[model samples]
Target: MDNFSFYDLQPKISNFPDEVLAGLSKQQKQIPPKFFYDEYGSKIFDQICELEEYYPTRTEFGILQQHSSDIADQIGENSLIIEYGSGSSQKICFLLDSLIKPWAYMPIDISREHMLSASKTIADKYPNLKVLGVYADYTTEMLLPEYAISSVQKKVIFFPGTTIGNLEPEEAIQLLKRSAMIVGSCGGMLIGFDMKKDPQILHASYNDSKGVTAAFNINLLTRINRELEASFDTNTFTHYAFFNPQKSRIEMHLISLVEQTVVISDRLFNFLEGESIHTENSYKFSVQEIENMSERTGFKLIRFWTDPKKHFYPG
Candidate 1:
């Protein structure tokens, strides 16, 4: 088990019933998008990432490949990279290859199997490199081990993907501030932020013609039924996603096809035929917005990488 550095995930699971109940009790029924990553959901997401309409994964990967050296330059040597999500992809591979003498790599995730598998694979690939995988929900406040890139050394937080965009601006700022505390004042954070772009493109990304995104979205309900013992007729709901141009964000919802009632945790809930449960949001930002976020969060904007169209940037 030492090879994987696994952490207990039951506490996180224990909170799931309450969290799901809390989100569902509100006037606008909801479920935090975090719940969308159960094993099946995670597998569906991998399929979504490969869809022609889902450009974030490939586009962001290009940025990593193109700017690896420049990013490694900022990170320098003997650094510890604390990645907020599973680094099973090539993003961390590129970073490790470019950086000189990185002290260790810590990749955190809510899935224990995912964290341990990724950690073990990375350890196997780089026999001399230290890969510590922590299984925990990174969205909430986190206190990593003291020796995990301690104050005596250089540390960098690499948060890849458009996950930052998944949070409201206020929540995003608070999360960045927490990241600041984790890395200390001297550390740097290389994060990903989607950019405001054509509404049509944004719409297509989340509402792919192939319906993979739809399956990925509805998987939340499937997860609820399986884990929380909820009565969600997944087939009675439809995946709905659209771009909110004014908010510079994309919203995902599951609209009930007909009036129905479901029970969760021994409580009853009613839904109208047209009722919706807002599930997730992807807020796109401009360069100025990201810079402002850094300023508000006690950090400074360093280098950034983006495609010519500015569809996305993860630096």
Candidate 2:
């Protein structure tokens, strides 16, 4: 029988209003990209991955399919796979299929309901595998279940999907260092990096023809409306995504179509016409940059695999 345990570190009611107000108050208004996963946002993202223009998910999966055996060999046996921002827990299935007696799977994420649902589904499929769901923002320091820490032969951090690109370089370095600590000396990390690519290709990935990406971006505001009792005319906000070559990032923003004021729990935030709230930034990296980052964070990259077209890398 598979045993599943869920830990709720995120509040039942999100602190999103506080985050929203703080971001809105900034000189250059911006919200953290992590805020995009409130149930609805998460579902929209799953759809975005299936879009023809969105290649990262598919590209990464191909690399995993071709290299899972090799990756499993490198990972060795009796390992505990801890995934940050586990999302649908789909990609890890490939790794789990290849790993030799992986003792447990710990999926840490901020979306409690989604994480629990995925964890249960994964448990059902991997009947002998232990699934522990930690409901907390993985960006912050987290406490792993005592059993996960004490019983595992090896602790491998499986951070796929190139999610690390969402963080600034400095923040990414810190997170890598933290993961190194959690995995301890004997363990290794298998991560994915979205390689730098043509600006046109990058632009199309975030601005799909079906406008699923736009809906995904706008859903953040809808989340605020539902959770914070905010009056946000979501229709009045347009989704905008563009590649900033200078910064080597894809920036997504919600542009206010008209001057408006939104109220959340007695607090008022005013937006002028054309004003935008920066929602997310996906940074692209070079192979050299990934090597340098791993070196700086004390991880020795044993191997890296990428598609023939070099669209994405899973190492």
The per-prediction tally of clashing pairs is 0, 0
Clash pairs detected, candidate 2: none
Runs in model 2 deviating more than 4 A are: 5-14
lDDT of 1 by residue, 108-187 (tens): 87767767777888888887677777877777876676656463478888898999989998889889998988887778
User: Candidate 2 residues 230-282, lDDT tens each?
Assistant: 89999899999999988889999999999999998888889999999999989
Error of 1 at 233 (Å): 2.5
Evaluate all candidate structures by whole-model CA lDDT and list the values in order: 0.84, 0.88
CA-RMSD of model 2: 2.2
For candidate 2, give the lDDT of residue 307.
Answer: 97
How far residue 33's Cα lies from its native spot in candidate 1, in Å, is: 1.1
Candidate 1 colliding pairs: none
Lowest summed lDDT across 10 adjacent residues in model 1 is found at 2-11
- Model 2: lDDT of residue 66: 91
Candidate 1 overall lDDT versus native: 0.84
